[model samples]
Target: MECSDARMLLVVLMIVVAGSRQASCNVVQFIFGDSLSDVGNNMYLTRSLARPSLPWYGIDFGNGLPNGRFSNGRTVADIIGDKIGLPRPLAFLDPSLNEDIILESGVNYASGGGGILNETGGLFLQRFSLYKQIELFRGTQELIRNKIGAEATDKFFQQSFYIVALGSNDFINNYLLPVYRDSWKYSDDGFNEYLMMTLEQQLKLLHGLGARRLIVFGLGPMGCIPLQRVLTSSGDCQEKTNNLAINFNKAAEKLLQDLSGNLPNTSFRFGDAYDMVNDVISNPDKYGFDNSDSPCCTIGRIRPSLTCIPVSRLCKDRSKYVFWDEYHPSDRANELIADEIIRKLGLSQLNTTNSFSQSTAPSPAPFS
Candidate 1:
């Protein structure tokens, strides 16, 4: 071939290779929510009680050093990052990390004790609510635009994955507080509806801010957590709390369905965490867990009032316990949940156009 022809062929090959590499690059993930998906944002807060930067919290995590993750190791966000072939995004509040690098990769805006409503975690006095988290995300968006220009930043978000795992704290920290008497004011169904409506508005706000691919995790089986179990006389699951979570999940599913129909070019997946964790609690043996009702770390009576302090008794084998502390799941259980999430919404599956439609039903199989 002539030298000019050979040069043209080489240019074509380079363009094809570059395009392929861009297509194969892992999708950037921006996480938002409460403690379930919180990496370490609570650690940055001064007066937050919902912190995990202490001994035994990250015992299973490498180096046995707590980086503010509530579990005995990684959270679902960390596991999902690994599964999706991306490094776990740095917490947006971590001062040690470079802001530019974090924005380029992704950022975790989740905070422990956070909730959908601004007043939800007010009892804690220092939690970043979902509304505030989104406000922070808006700052990140500005930084992204500064770094890559507005057009490129818009495109970046279009190709990114957004995971939101919140609302559980609304019940755990706010409505259920004896001092609040939220139930008396709003009844059970009324409260759940209120939460769903607020969540729908926040999700729509996120979509407006450039998120296209989104995964909204439903409230888990809060009644079966160690904290709730301790509240019961027999230490059994609180059926009322469980029912509330189920109702919320059902409403959340419908919300996603509605959002998909209303929003243009948006793909929403509702992660049924209530069903996922409930299965593990119901059949611990099936998931290689020895204890599902009690937490691995406890002090007084395995209750919400007694958190995993520095002197708290730690479990010998953390993997066998479904919960690490009173409120959070063990790292093993997190792994299971994350794996299930990936299986249901893998990168290959996410690439399809069918995911954009409301007609596409989520996978119904429970986590193994």
Candidate 2:
């Protein structure tokens, strides 16, 4: 064989070995959710309530400029990506970001106004709901197939990690709003059943499409959000809403357990973000947070400005605060929550698609 051909063969061997050794790195965290998980997908879409274009938004990012993140800097998803040894997952709509990034570390299909239902927001300003995001995920896989061949794409699918964080919008926008009061007739049992069924179908679709390992993030305490507190006039946590979230999470956990049972050795896990955020609310100083009832980003305990910008009021030290705005956790706060999730899953990193320490190469595809 020619020397150049030999050199090319060596490079191929190295790449194959790298991909195999990193089999445990299964997670290419495909994020989907509302403002909490949105990393800027909406910024590239259109003008909507979900867009984050103002100051203090990206203060913590290395760039020191707003990049459409809902926080002062580094969202939970971004921090999780950093911890998992992957590049920050790119917003699916960022023109500068491309398919190479998606193929490498997954994509962020989250939109600020996103919810369970498409009608949750009107057209023009409509965001990518969880369902829509999953559809986009399928498209991403097709992109992979075209770029990396069907065989390699399947290998990536069997080894990659899928992380899902969502559901707040269903509670806040669909249930709480009068526009959907009659439509959804929001009750814990009814809502839980609907969400669980939706989740089950979605998971089944993903599994059929090649997702093996999955980590599901449960809802946080929506009652504690400044929006709920201010809009509902309760000024206290809403037990009913929180209970609904708990029910949804319970049903989801059961569904995941059942799915795992049928999927053989593939691991499907759940993390309780509700408890993590609630713990911060219940015990602030323990987490180094000074306040839970109020956000550091807006005036008093009122909701965040219609347009989240840097010039808007902000806290002096974000690390000392639990939430940056009415609906999102501060960067430090998300880090703590992500740490707990890691501990629960026995993970050393937050963004991995697989635990490189635990996974093995494809394992003969279960058919060979």
What TM-scores do the predictions have? 0.86, 0.84
Q: Pick the candidate with the highest TM-score.
A: 1
Q: For residues 23-52, what per-residue lDDT tens digits would candidate 2 score against the true structure?
A: 434446677777777888877776676677
Candidate 1 lDDT over residue span 1-368, tens digit each: 99999999999999988655433344667899888788788988989878887777666666667878888777887766665555467888888666456544678899988999888877777888999999998998887777657876787778888889998888888788877667468888899989988999999999999999898887778888888888878989998888888898899989998999999998998876566678989999998889998888877553464358866777767778898888988888887887777776664433222211332111211112
Candidate 1: regions farther than 4 A off: 1-26, 300-306, 346-368
Residue 85 lDDT in candidate 1: 54
Backbone clash total for model 2 is 17
Backbone clash count, each prediction separately = 0, 17
Which run of 10 residues does model 1 get worst, by summed lDDT? Answer: 359-368
* Residue 30 lDDT (model 2): 72
Deviation (Å) of 341 in candidate 1: 2.5
